[model samples]
Target: MTAGGARRGNTRFVVAGLFVAFVLAGFVSGYASSHPDGLEKVAEEKGFLGQADDHAFANWPLADYAVSGIGNERLAGGVAGVIGVSIAFVVGGLLVFGAVRLRSRGPGRASAPTGDRGPDDPGPGGPGGVGTDAAGAGAAPAA
Candidate 1:
């Protein structure tokens, strides 16, 4: 339990949250509210609902709530939601992992266990400062 892991949250909690998303996507999505959401309902009331056309990406395979060929709307929507949830989970996890790894490996870190003496701190050959001779002068190190 390092500092980073605590900030990120427990693994069990993360897995549980993802499982809940999967369940909702695979099952509860079929029962999602049928009425037009707030924006669509407002547009319809304002007499401009027809102005809204299909999404620009409508031709995509999962274009509509349902798959292209799936006749059963409920099943299609549920399946689509489940797939979307899985993809989101994987992508999100990968992004988090990459960020943490990059942060740890970034230049601010030091190879020595003492860790992060900062740019101004004299590196090894102590007190010479960078690119300097051991006498702490602004001269190159002696061969």
Candidate 2:
């Protein structure tokens, strides 16, 4: 496909993905169970739940899967989920951009190291590293 076509397709894909992410984070997350997860359940069953200390960021605004100062539990959770998803998307995009930028700034690389071979060096193809064979007829096209 053409570069423009490929870019348009990628854009569409990203838009669809973001739409789904936002929907799930802002709406579907509200229906998620509030019960303890496996780790918490296991601790509770083992009678060690009370021994667990609060997380370092337990007092953070988005801690406990809910945003602080929100009266509605579902809304608070939804808002937190959306915030988390948005933050993750932005962070991931930044990482990809940084990686691409770094790679572009590095030295250029060729598919094959053509410089190592001396001017007189006959490649694996014998005679001419490229072009015609010894038989006279054009080389049966490189693989």
Candidate 3:
């Protein structure tokens, strides 16, 4: 693989690792905020708290970070936390996958192969060789 490909692969791995770490951290140590955050505080102050719509899944099989009707709260919370983490990881992975695919095309593409020319060597086709004319630039030349 080319250096650029290797770098992109490494970046993907690093991002995947970070996603796993974030999920594990949230699961092992609970993630509930002790105080209401900025949005919640603003809602309370604005007296529009009643404007909130009840989520159909508010009392879902897993709600409020605890599996509903579970005998053990801690176990239920941990299971729910892990489920949340997995969902986040899957979503992040899908986004990254889409970005990579999208970036693999077009003129400003990052993963394009770079010709190996010495500092003194004239690039591809020499001085007048294979200039990046519109047609030449857009064509995907054979590997």
Candidate 4:
């Protein structure tokens, strides 16, 4: 891999590690703010707590960030948190995968071969393509 590629991979790793650390800290410390969180606090201060109606899924599994029917609050909360993280990770991975797949192809075209080419190669912004100097005034300079 090029230095830039390696650097980007390392940066991603660091970010992922930090995310894991933060989630673990939240789970272990149970050190959330004692103050009422945003919506709850606003409702209380504005005397609009009654404005909020019970959600349709109020009794649904995973409601209130706890597993349904779990006897232990702490364990239920932890399991719910882990499930949330897992869902987030899967969704994020699928999004990135789809984006990469889409960008690997031209509009209505098959995926391109992943290859290194000279700077003169005619890509989407190359001399004859859209955003090329010959085609537009604000075209980007060739790399």
Candidate 5:
């Protein structure tokens, strides 16, 4: 396919993926099992669950898979899930942007490399080069 068609296809794929992610985060997460999983179940079965301490971030707003201050349990969990997904998406995008910017400039390069032209020089097409002028056609002769 052409470049524009490929780009549009990629965009549609990304949009569909994002839509699925949002739906899962904001809806399906509420249906997740409330019972403790294998590890937690084993701890409880061994009678050591009481001795376990809460996690360091246990008091955070999004802790325990639920958002704080929301009355409905399922709704709170769904909101927390969506918020978590959004935060992760934003952080990932920023990291990709930074990496692309650095790669475009090459290693140890801080600025783009320009042609070796001085202030008084008309190196390319001599005095009337290919650049726009006051009339927006060709470069004007230097004073």
Candidate 6:
């Protein structure tokens, strides 16, 4: 791992992935299919579109993919999209980072070793996949 805590050479990949995702979400998504998405289309085809229940928070700001009170529809949609993307990225990153940190610390560590690949770690076969025994002693290779 690097001094910043991210695994060595992984920070670049993560940053690039995030950049690509944000670009796709913020800009490219505007050109996506305008036809009702799966659920809405299904509802319409099923003749239940009129019976669709109203969203409880439909009046909330940034609801229905548009920012409330924004005069320009296009700008409002873009702003709301960007905001949603940013929030999702931040929340997802925090959750993932927290989970990884928590998992890396292990269960009730009592002066555990600093390096990764602990003895309890599973092998390439994964948990109980023939090769990965509880003791981490891999099964013998097939002839």
Best by TM-score: 2
In model 6, which range of ten residues has the least summed lDDT? 134-143
Is candidate 1 or 2 superior in TM-score? 2
lDDT of 5: 0.70
Q: CA shift at 106, candidate 4, in angstroms?
A: 4.3
Query: Which model is ahead, 4 or 6, in terms of TM-score?
Result: 6
**Tens digit of per-residue lDDT, candidate 6, span 61-93:** 978888889898767777788788789877877
The regions of model 1 sitting more than 4 angstroms off are 1-9, 105-143
Give the per-residue lDDT digits (tens) of candidate 5, residues 1-143. 12225578787887788789988999998887789999889999999889888899999999987999999998998899889888887788787765554333223444448755767332343554223122222222221
Model 4: residue 96 alpha-carbon error in angstroms: 2.3
Highest lDDT model number = 2
Per-residue CA lDDT of candidate 3, range 28-65, in tens? 54555558789878999998877989888897897777
TM-score on alpha carbons, each prediction = 0.59, 0.65, 0.52, 0.56, 0.60, 0.61
lDDT of each: 0.69, 0.73, 0.63, 0.64, 0.70, 0.67
Candidates, ranked, lDDT: 2, 5, 1, 6, 4, 3
lDDT of 6: 0.67
**TM-score between model 1 and native:** 0.59
Clashing pairs in 3: 125-129
Descending-TM-score candidate ranking: 2, 6, 5, 1, 4, 3
Per-residue error at 92 for model 2, in Å? 1.0
**TM-score preference between candidates 3 and 6, better one:** 6
Of candidate 4, the 10-residue stretch with the lowest lDDT total is 134-143
Error of 2 at 18 (Å): 0.9
